[model samples]
Target: MSAHNFLGNLQTYTDGLVEEGKTPAVSVAVWKDGQLHLAASGILNVETGVEATTDSIFQIGSITKIMTVSIIMQLVDEGKIDIDMPVRTYLRDFAIADAEASETITVRQLINHTNGMSGDFFPDESRQSGNQIARYLDRINRLPLIHPVGEYYSYSNAAFAVAGRLIEVVTGVSWYNAIEERIYQPLGMSHAISHPMDVIRYRAAIGHFADQTHPEGWKQTEQLYLSMGQAAAGATLTMRAEDLITFGRAHLEGGITQTGERWLSKTSLAQMQVQQVNVPTVSKAFTKGYGLGWGLLHHKQPEDTVYGHGGVTYGQLSMLRVIPKQNICFAILINCSEMGMMTEITNRFLNELASLDYSEAQAKFVNLSSVEQKRFLGTYASLGDGFRIVSEEDHLVAYYEDTVLKTPVERYSLGALEDDFFYGFNRDGSVALELQFKDCQKDGRYSYLFSGGHLRKRVLE
Candidate 1:
């Protein structure tokens, strides 16, 4: 399909999703080569009934991590910091459950999420305490590490918290201000911002948690506090999808801003994209890993490596994907509770962009006998997600751990389409659930259960 027609179809689909009560608002943008296309649907704020526009801002969750870490790369370019240097060389107070491991943790390890620390920990800080990078690190000793200092791949939000502090200490300014002075202003990202209050000045989109069955399907949610420690999160960077794509474009072009200013040298920019650690696959379309703050994705077919990131703020979710070789990038921001919808949109769009047909390659049905299926039945978990696979009369029902389940939780009855691929009803939404099993041991032990590009490492069985 032509790019124009593809965007048209995307616009129609997005509008239908919102009008059909699937989401309150959605902002989508596609940047291919030098041209960019944007589309929006539904209201930015259902309570006020503000229609979303090309300029409407939505929080780009962990997508802010790339921004925060990019500044760190700038520091690297200036010789203010070295990626390989141990983090303790700058922050002496940094500590974890393992003293030896703590001393060995490097800036590279933290950025790539190989530091072995449990990445969970979001403490809300009042705006007045914005200068809090040091205070956050002082208490890091209380938290425990999941593995050793540089064992393997696991997502770490806490690592970015410490990274924010590193930025503050080296630059002689708050990490938040450093971001604005170094990133937003330099790149001319006028709509990009880190403060929640600053969002009020614009046509802000209020995140909504919708229960369609409730008397009123939507409930407005308060903006989350972006603590100083979480500067990496952009504390919820509210901005237009196209501008976000521009940011990604800068990285793709070896750190050159649109206005002809060179932000970082080609060497440093390449360092950011090079794969640092092999991470769990999140979807069948791409083999994902961590590279600095950006996600390093290896497309299964084209096998092209792309850098992108996904962000979440309460019920709001945003995603950005960029392929430098093709000069193509896309961003999707939605204010809703159904995150699976984001993947549904992204996967189809990606497949269409590549002119690849998933159905053609869909694995043929292969049913494992009841006795053989036992190996697939178990609980798998990562930091913030998990699922339990149980056999129900020869069929496998995956009880996903979700707070919004109709009962205690939702169960996805999966049927085999390929030897290791399965599809089923993905909630009440239009999207169907597709799952792939990978890295299984010869003895039938699987290490990661990937869906939506978020790898939930096997915690049991």
Candidate 2:
């Protein structure tokens, strides 16, 4: 299809999809061959009955991490910081519960999520103050190292908080301000704002939760944002889909802005996309590997690699995908927490536009022996998340718990895949879970469960 017809069909599909009640609102922007196409449909808020427009700002969640890392890279370009240098080189008093890790963790490890620090270390007090980064530092002693430093890949929000502090210390500015001056302003992203207060000036979309009790089958989320302390890790950044894609285009153009200005060095941009660690297969639904701040999606061919990130905040879901080989990038923003819908949209968008499919490769399913299955049947936990796998009628079922968000318990059935990996399907048979058991202990039980970008330890009863 021609580009004109493809974008028109995308817009029509988006309109119909929203009307199907998957989500209350969504905004999408596509950048291909130096042209921009945008689409929007549905209401910004069910309560207000306000129509969403192409310019409506939705929380980009962890996509903000890219901006955070961009500022850190800029510091590197200026010789003000070094990725290999220990974070303590700048934040002299920075220390975590693990003294050795506190002293030895480098800035690169923090950005690439290899620091082994607890991933979800949000404090209630941090949300109540503007000096959240400082409060986060004061409470750093509470977070324990989940694994040995540089042992493996584990998503770390605290790591980025440390990165944010490093940015603040080296630049003499707040993380939010640094992002504005360095990224938003440089890229001409006028619709982007890292601070929640600034959101009021734009046509911002309110988040919605899937609530069967509500008349519309969804309700507005009580909280509008996450803890300010984790802002660098994607707590409170909002932007129009257009602006989000513009940010992606900067990286796509190798640090050059749309107006021919150099926002970042080509060397730093290349380093950010280089794979730092290979993620677990189960987590490949999100990413195949980790870069500095980007998620590397390795397609069938090496040159077809795609760089992107996903974000979630309260009841919103956002995704940004950039395929440099095709000079194509797209951003999707939705107000409701409907992940299944987001996945569907992402697959369709990529397949239709770039002729690239991100659908999970069909794993060779195998039946594990009863004893082998028992190795994975137990409780696994990270900081605020956990899973309990139980066997029923020769099949494994997992119960997921989200303590931080207080979400309802969810259940998934695990089908054994190759090499201790499992495909988790919801009751509706959607392949929403990717997980693996790794690091066997001397007692024959696996020491860790890798899923959702977290290396959760098996909880011993």
Number of the top candidate by lDDT? 2
Position 34, candidate 2: lDDT: 82
Would you estimate the TM-scores of all the predictions?
0.84, 0.96
| Per-residue lDDT of candidate 1, residues 124-230 (tens digit) | 56655535667778767866666556866667778888998888888998776887899889888888877655888777677778766644488777644445566
Give me the displacement of residue 438 in model 1, in angstroms: 9.4
List the RMSD of every prediction in angstroms: 3.9, 1.7
Worst window of 10 by summed lDDT in candidate 1 = 354-363
lDDT of 1: 0.75
Against the unseen true structure, what C-alpha lDDT does each candidate score? 0.75, 0.87
TM-score top scorer: 2
State model 2's lDDT: 0.87
lDDT for 278 (candidate 1): 79
In candidate 1, position 287 carries an lDDT of: 66
